[model samples]
Target: MQPITPFFMFEGNAEEAMNFYLSIFEGASISHITRYGANEVGKEGSVQQAIFTLNGQTFMCIDSPIKHDFTFTPALSLYITCDTEEEIDRLYGALSIGGAVLMPINAYPFTQKFAWFNDQFGVSWQLNLPGKGEGF
Candidate 1:
């Protein structure tokens, strides 16, 4: 199966935030943090980034540099293709907690069932459940 993962950009506290996430989610594993050296793009010894895996999905995070413009937008949302209605509902509810819902979970013209929301972490997601005529 193909897995869809998201990469988030943090101001400078990526390590702390990622650690906090690992603490909240059971079975979350964080890889060792890597630093930039003279051979890298940024200043030597600067923290490069790390990767965190929750359940089986991987998320990559990095500290945003002064030169990079990092902003979260709806256009960059991560789509979760759910297999069942119950699964979709469960995830939709969990992700919507403490977050704003841009599109309520419901049936749409183009899709049988779909929901769009921005999670508490400022990440956008589009949850979709295929219809009768849909293809995987």
Candidate 2:
């Protein structure tokens, strides 16, 4: 298990958000999901909690039985290191759909390619291609 894992509290869309993330990343998968059973505070079929991986990093989330005014913010984001420009572009395109772009995909002094955006679920992400001879 990872010592540090990101946890999300969704407004009843935990499963949908997990599926969307899995579709965007190449090696993503939902390792486990425990849905709310009968008489639970949340809907019986809703996600009580879920464990998933995206690009090899594990994350967890749950469907909140009570609604909250806040959602994800760019204050904290999933920073993804990519190996190729194609990977960065693909990620940028997918994550940018129906969400805001904090920074456009372009060449930067630190990296040859980069992008920052929030996905439809309001999860922020930064995709960066490392400089040559550097680790990704």
Candidate 3:
């Protein structure tokens, strides 16, 4: 089977969200982007499709032309295994702003530090620092 890449659909702010993520994560970059032109289905200059990588994990996203009643849900999240306290703290601070926290950063029995939240763009995320954690 081909490698599966995560995809995201944004109402109209896919570009903004992509840039925001690139700024926050190390080794993040936009690999490719196709913007809507004048009179296109989507808003002019908006992302029709974009490919980006965060810390080498590739993801696809788009500014959807069709408006829908639904958006991102917390059921599926992007999980990150952080290397240090500073790393998790920085990511949690950035991702949790203007978003709902499902679980605040704390030491749990399964992990030394962990947090789960939805980002400003409604993307769910979980940050973990494995120390005493059984599963790494």
Candidate 4:
């Protein structure tokens, strides 16, 4: 397990969200998952807990058995440093579908290219093409 990992709680779409994220990042994978059983409060087959790796950063997610109005927020977001403009563009496009863009991809003084958006699952992400000798 990673020393520190982000944990997400979804109403019922944990599996779907996990797969969607895996599809977007290369080398991503579901390391393990434990689903709700017949007698559990959650619907059978729903994710009780899951461990996933986005490239190499590990994350934990679960399908919350109880309802809550809260969700992912922009205050805290997944920040990715892209290798090229094409990569940032591709990620921005794919993640922006069915979602909203907080900052459209464009050339910025801090970075050559940058974009910030919330994915369909309401997860906020910031993608950037780092400038020389710097990280975004």
Candidate 5:
């Protein structure tokens, strides 16, 4: 079976979103990108299709030609297991900006430190610093 990669569809700002994520995570890079040209279905210079990696996980994204009423929701999220409080704190501070926080960063009964929020691009994310012997 083929690997299932998470995909994102943006109206016109996929490149911006991809760059934003790359700046936040270590070892992240764009593997390939195809931009729209003149007379194309999508906006000129917008992302036609792209593949990128974040912390070793591959993801795909595109700048959609057609606009849709629907967008990303908190139901499906990118989960990150951070190794330290500093990592979680930095990530939470960076991701929470210009976004809505479903759960602010704090200690929870299930974990030592955790946060859940939707990024400016409407992508949901959860950052967790798990305690010893704990897993999520």
Candidate 6:
């Protein structure tokens, strides 16, 4: 397991968000969902949690309690390193839907390609492609 992995707290949209992520990232897969009621710890029919893997990295997500104040912030951004421009473009486009773009996708001094944006689910991400001075 990755020592430091991201865990997202969704507002009753964990399953939908996980599916959205899986559709965008190649080789992504979601484990069978574990409902909250199944564990006898939550209201019936409520989603508890689910584990998702993308490009061999694991990320866990769960539905936040309705009464809790769980909001995604810019301080917690996910950085995705891409090997090619195509991959960067694909991910950037998919993640930008229904979301705000902090920086439009473009070539940068430090990378062959780069972009930064927050997804619809309020998760921020920085997509980077290795450049001439950087080793992949």
For every model shown, the clashing-pair count is: 0, 0, 0, 0, 0, 0
Off by over 4 Å in 3: none
- Candidate 3 has an lDDT of 0.93
Output the number of the lDDT-best candidate.
Answer: 5
Output the lDDT of residue 115, model 2: 86
Q: Report the Cα RMSD per candidate.
A: 5.0, 1.8, 1.1, 1.5, 0.8, 2.4
108-134, model 6: which lDDT tens digit per residue?
Answer: 777778888889999999888888677
Which scores greater on TM-score, model 2 or model 5? 5
Predicted structure 1: lDDT = 0.77
- Between prediction 3 and prediction 6, the one with superior lDDT is 3
lDDT of 2 by residue, 9-81 (tens): 8988899889988998778999999999999799899999899998778899999999788889999998888
Report the Cα lDDT for candidate 5: 0.94
TM-score of each model, in listed order? 0.66, 0.90, 0.95, 0.93, 0.97, 0.86
lDDT of 1 at 17: 63
Candidate 1, residue 45: the lDDT equals: 56
RMSD of 1: 5.0
Model 4 stretches astray by more than 4 angstroms? none
- Please give the CA lDDT of all the candidate structures: 0.77, 0.88, 0.93, 0.90, 0.94, 0.83
- lDDT of each residue in 38-65, candidate 4, tens digit only: 9989989999999999969999999999
Expressed as tens digits, the lDDT of each residue in 26-126 for candidate 5 is 89999999999999898999999999999999999999999899999999999999998999999998888999999989999999999999999999999
Q: Pick the candidate with the highest TM-score.
A: 5
Model 1 lDDT tens row, 92-133: 877777778999999989777899998776678898998887
Which portions of model 2 miss their true places by more than 4 Å? 133-136
Ranking by lDDT: 5, 3, 4, 2, 6, 1
